[model samples]
Target chain A: MRRFAALVRRDLRLSLRAGTDATTAVMFFVVTVALFPLAIGPESTVLARIAAGVIWVAALLASLLSLERLFANDYEDGGLDLLALSPLPLEAAALAKVAAHWLVTGVPLILAAPVLALLLDMPAGGFAVLMASLALGTPSLSLIGAAGAALTLGARRGGVLLSLLVLPLFVPVLIFGAGAIDAALHGVAARPHLLLLGGFLAAALPLAPIAAAAAIRQALS
Target chain B: MALPDRMAYLTVAMHRFANPARFQRIATAILPWSAGLTVLLLAAGLYLGLVASPADYQQGDTVRIMYIHVPSAWMALFIYANMALASAVGFVWRHPLADLFCRAVAPVGAGFTAVCLITGSLWGEPMWGTWWVWDARLTSVLILFFLYLGYIALVNAFDDPVRGLKAGAILVLVGVVNLPIIKFSVDWWNTLHQPASVSRLGRPALDPAMLTPLMVMAAAFMAYFVTLALLRTRAELLNRRIQVLQMARGAS
Candidate 1:
C-alpha cells in the first residue's frame, strides 16, 4: 500500500514537473473554444446555443491528446515491467497511474472549463452543470483512455490508433455530459444523465484497472 | 450409430478441424462446397424475398429492404459476438486457434456491418423519408462498425503479430460488454429508432412471409462466415509458417 502510494506520488511529481499534459490540455480547451466565437461570428446567442457541444468536444479532444503518454513512456523505459514485478498488484499500479493522470489532466481541464465556458458564451445557468458533468465525466475519460493507452502501449502510429479505439467508447460520456448541461439549460432535470455518468464511472473504476493491467502484462510478455 | 449418436459424431468430426493443420486440410476440401452453398442459398433467398414474397400493406415494396437489411444486421451482430467469444477464449486459455478465430472474424464482421448500414439507408430513403437519423440502433451499428475497424487496426499495428492479437483481444472483450447497452439504448431512452423485433422473446412481430427469406439469407450469411473464417485462418497459419521458414534460413 505504501509502495502504491509512493508510486502515485512519484507519477504526480513527474506530471507536475513536466507540466505538458495539464498545460497543453488547458491551452487546447481554451483555444478551441475561443475559435468557435470567431468562426460563428461573435453572436452571443449562437455562441450560447452551441457552447455545450463546443466545450464538451474540446474537452474530449484535449483529454484524448494527452492519452498516449499514459503508459507509452512507462512501457518504453521499462517502468511498466518494474510495476508488473512489484509487490503491489498490477491493477493497483494501473489505478495509481490513472489517478495521477486524472490529477494532471482531468482536474486541470475541469478547473479551466469555466474560463473557457465564458469565452464560449455559455449562459451562467449552464456553468454549474458544465462543471458538474465534467467533474464526473473526465475521470471516466481518464479511466477509459487508460485502457486505450495501455492497449496501444507500443503500437506504431499509436496516437491515431488510440483515438480510433477510444472515441467510440467515449461517446456515451460525451452524450451525457453535454446532455446534462443542455437539459439544465432547458429547465429540465439533468439528474438521469448525471446518474448514468456516475454509473459509467463506477463501472470503469473497477473494470478499467483490470483491463489495463492485462494489456500491460501482455505488452510486456 | 443412431440419430443422436450420429449428431455427436458430427460434432467431434467438426472439432477435429480445431487443429490448425486439420483445419487447413478441411478448409481446402470444403471451400468449394461452402462457396457453392452460399451462391445457391443467396440466389434462392433473393428471388424469394425480392420477387415471390408479397409486398407489405403498409411499407409496400420498401419492405423488401428488410430482406437484405435484416440478415446483414444479424450477421453484423453475430460476427462481433463470435469475435468476442474467440477473444475471451484466447485471453483465458491462451489458445492460438482462438487468436486466429478473432483475426479471421473481424473483417468479415466489418463487411457485414457496412452492408447493414448501406441497406438500412436504402430502406430509410423511401420509408423514413431521410437518409439517416441519430437513432439508437443505427448509431450503435455504426459504433460496431468502428469497433471492428479499431480491432483490425490494433491487430495489425504491432511489429509482432502476437502482440497485435493480444491487444486486439482486449478490444473485442470491451466491445462485447458495450453491445448489450447499444442494443437496448433505444428502448431505455427516447430515440427516433424503433425497438427490438427479431431479438425479442414471444412471437417475432415480423410476418412469416418476410421471416422466411430473412432467415434463409441469415443462414447463408452464417455459412459464408464459417467458410471465410476457415479460409482466413488457413491463410494466417500459412503466413506464420513462411515467417518461421524465413527466420530459420536467416539464422542458418
Candidate 2:
C-alpha cells in the first residue's frame, strides 16, 4: 500500500517537475473551446447551443495531448520492467499511473471546462451538471487513454495511433457527459445521464488497468 | 466410449493438427470445398436477392440493398466475436494458430464492415432520405469498423511479430467488453436505428419470399468468410516459414 502511494507520488512529482502536462492540457482545453465560437460564429445563442459538446470534446482532446507521456518515458528507460517486477502487482501499478495521470491532466481540464463553458455562453443552470459530469467523465478518459498509451508504448507514430485506438472508445463518455449538461440546460433531470457516466467510470476503472498492465507486460516481453 | 474419454479423444485429434504442417494439409483439403460453396451460394444468393425478391411497396428496388447490407453487417459482428474468442484462446493457451487466425481474419472483418457501411449509406439516402444519420446502430457498426482497424494496425506495428500479436490480443479482448457499453450509451443518447433484437426471436417479420434471399445471402457471406479466412491463415503460415528460412540462411 505504501509502495502504491509512493508510485503515484513519484508520477505526480515527475509531472509537476516537468510542469507541462497540466498546463498544456488546460491551455489546450481553453484554446480549443475558444476556437469553436470563432469557427461556428460568435453569436452567444449559437455558442450556448454548442457549449456542452464543445467543452466535452475539447477536454477529451486536451487529455489526449499528454497521454503519450503516461508510460512512454518509463517504458523507454526500463522503469516499467522494474514496476512489473516489484512487489506491487502490475495491475495496481497500472492503476497508480492512470490515477496520477487523471490527477495531473484530467482534473485541470475539468476545472478549465466551466470557465470555457461560460466563454461559450452556457446557461447558468447547466454549470453544476457540467462540473459533475466532467468529474465523472474525465477519469474514464484517463483510464481508457492509459490502455491506449501502454498499447502504443514503443510503436512508431504512437501518438497518432493512440488517438485512433482511443477515440472510438471515448464516444460513450462524450455522449453521456454532453448529454447530462444538455439535459440540465433544457430543464430536464440530468440524473440518468450522470448515473450512466458513473457506470462507465466504474466499468473502466478495473478493466482499463488490467488492459494497460497486459500491454505493458507485452511491451517488456 | 465414456463422455470424458470421448472429449479427451477429440482434443487429441484437434491438437494433432496444431502443427503448422498438419494444419496446412487440412487447410488445403478444406480450401476447395469452401471456395466451391462460396461461389455456388453467392450466385444463388445474388439471383434471389437482386432478381427474385419482391420490391417493397414503399421502397421499390432499393429494398434489395438490404440483401447485401444486412449480411455483411452480420458477418462484421460475427468475425469480431470470433476474433475475441480466438484472442482469449491464444492468451490462455498460448496457441500459435489462434494468433495467426486473428491476423488472418481482421482484414476480412474490416472488409465486411466497409461493405456494411457503404451499402448502408446507399440504402439510407433512399430510405432515411439522408446519406447518413448519427443513429445508434449505425454509430455502433462504425465503431466496430474502427476497432477492426485499430486491431490490425497494432498487430502490425511492432518489429517483433509475437509482441504485436500479444498486444493485439489484449486490445481485442478489451474491445469485446466495451462493445456493449458503447452500444448502450449511444442508444440512451439517441436511437435512430431500428431496435433489431426484437425481431430475432422468430422469423424476422419478413415475407417468406424475401426472407429466403436474405438467408441465402447470409449463408453465402459466411461461406465467403470461411474461404477467405482459411486462405489468409495459410498465407500467413507460409510467410512465417519463408521468414524462418531467410533468417536461417543469414545466420548460416
Best by DockQ: 1
Segments of candidate 2 deviating more than 4 angstroms: B1-14, B181-190, B197-199
Off by more than 4 A, model 1: B1-18, B25-33
True contacts reproduced, candidate 2: 0.62
Best by lDDT: 2
Docking class of 1: medium
lDDT by residue (B33-144, candidate 2, tens digit) is 9999999999999999999889999899998998899899889888988999889878876778888999999999999999999999999898888999987778878899
Q: In candidate 1 chain A, what residue range of length 10 has the lowest lDDT sum?
A: A114-123
CAPRI-style grade of the A/B interface in model 2: medium
Interface RMSD of 2: 0.7
